[model samples]
Target: MRTAVGIDLGGTELRAALVAEDGRLLARRSTRTDAAGGPEAVLAQMTGLVADLDLAGARPVAVGVGAPGPLDAEAGVVTGPPTLAGWHGFPLRERLAAALGLSVAIDNDGHAAALGEWRFGAAIGRRHFVYVTVSTGIGGGVVCDGRLLRGRGGLAGHVGHMIVTDDDVVCSCGNRGCWEAVASGTAFGRQARRAAAADPAGRIAALAGTAPADARHVGTAAREGDPAALALVAEEARRLGAGIVGLIHLYSPEVVVIGGGLSALFDLFAPVIADAVATRAMPAFRDVAVVPAALGPDAGLVGAAALVLAPN
Candidate 1:
């Protein structure tokens, strides 16, 4: 079977995989991203990972990378994604190609995830769909009429930056009231921390341990039936639902697939999200399915591989 090298580059982690054309992951490795060490260090880490995979003898046809963006996909350059410091205008494609001696493709992580799902996961056979990842931050990708919708500057699916509130929560994008600012895992953690500080008796304080409160703690607390944590999760669901409504209005996708680390809480949030979308969306859009991504954390890596196996 023909194979390809796939890399999912995130702010904190780097995942590399050898993926067959049939969407099977043959071998994979993951490690911490040397993001604080700057772009050169990140490149070295990626190169090493790819080299390890290459030694498996698959002889990949090309290398595909799914990375945090604000990127120039056409030029194969990263254009200052907030999560990845020191990567502005970095020639990621060129560097990878030079290091691996193979053709390379790059895209926004969200877009890659969407493509991955469309090709291999939840959105399979769906002509129009959206993939949203609600992790430390939120990001999204849209597929319209069976093609990935990469806007004029390859920045089309930045749904997280869509303003959702009038509150003063600032986003890493330097904006206030973005959906990410108020509803992402980071936002949920921030709210949990404040709640814990305000009410020392709350479950969040106990669950937080030595580290600061985060979305995981909130989810754990909710699962354990902590009222405060349950409330927080509900609020996040509402916010996320509101955003899904907006996406439905804009793209009219047949389904909206939610992924990322926070998606583990989908069972807790899906009902509220479904209700919000059902009630608030236009009558015509009320039936749109809101579902968890089937590919899980592998979506980006598989989607990155699709860049080489299926370019659309």
Candidate 2:
């Protein structure tokens, strides 16, 4: 089977994989990102990981990368994603291509994930859809009329940054009331931590103990039928659903696929999201399906590979 190299470069971790033509991940390796070590260190780490995947014996024809955004996909340059400090204006595609001695393609992680789903996952056969990853912060990709919607500078599908509410919480993008600011996994954790501090005897507090709490603690408490945890999750789902409703109104997509770290709790969030859309979305767009991503955590990796395996 023909194969390619795919990389998912994130703020905390760097993952590399060998993906077959059919989207199966044949081999994979990952390491914690050396953000403190700067771009050169990260590049060396990434190259070493790719070399290790090469030993798996599938001569990859090309390489594809899904990197954090504010990037110029057309120019193959990374223009300073907040999470990836020191990557401003770096020619990622060209550097990787030269190092690997092969063709290389790169795009925003959200766009890559969307392409993966469109080509090999849940959004298959759908001409209109949106893929949203709700993790540390929200990120998204859109497929319109069977094509990835890459707006000017490849910044089109930044649905997370969309102003979804009236709130004081500032998003990493230095904005107030962004969907990500209110509904992302980071936001959920922050809220949980505050709630736990206020209610020392509550179930959420008991689950979190003294350590920093995140969305996972909330999920655990919710599963145990804790009322506060359940309420927090419900509110998060509502916020996420509210943003998704906007996407439906704007893009008229057939389905909205949810992925990322929080997707592990998709079963918990799905019903609430459905209700938000049903009640708030315009009557004409309420029929859109909101579902979990089919590829789960592998979506980014497979989607990155799709960049090289199947170009726009």
**Residue pairs with backbone overlap in model 2:** none
lDDT agreement of model 2 with the native: 0.90
Q: lDDT of all predictions, in order shown?
A: 0.91, 0.90
Prediction-by-prediction clash tally: 0, 0
Candidate 1 lDDT over 1-312, as tens digits, reads 999888999988999999998899999988999989999998999999987774366778999999998898889999998888888889999998998899999999998888889889999889899999999889989999888998877889999999988999889889999999988888888888987887777888888876788888888999999999999999989999999999999999999999998899999999999999889999999999999999999999999999889868
In angstroms, how far off is 292's CA in candidate 1?
A: 0.6
- Residue 16, candidate 2: C-alpha displacement in angstroms: 0.4
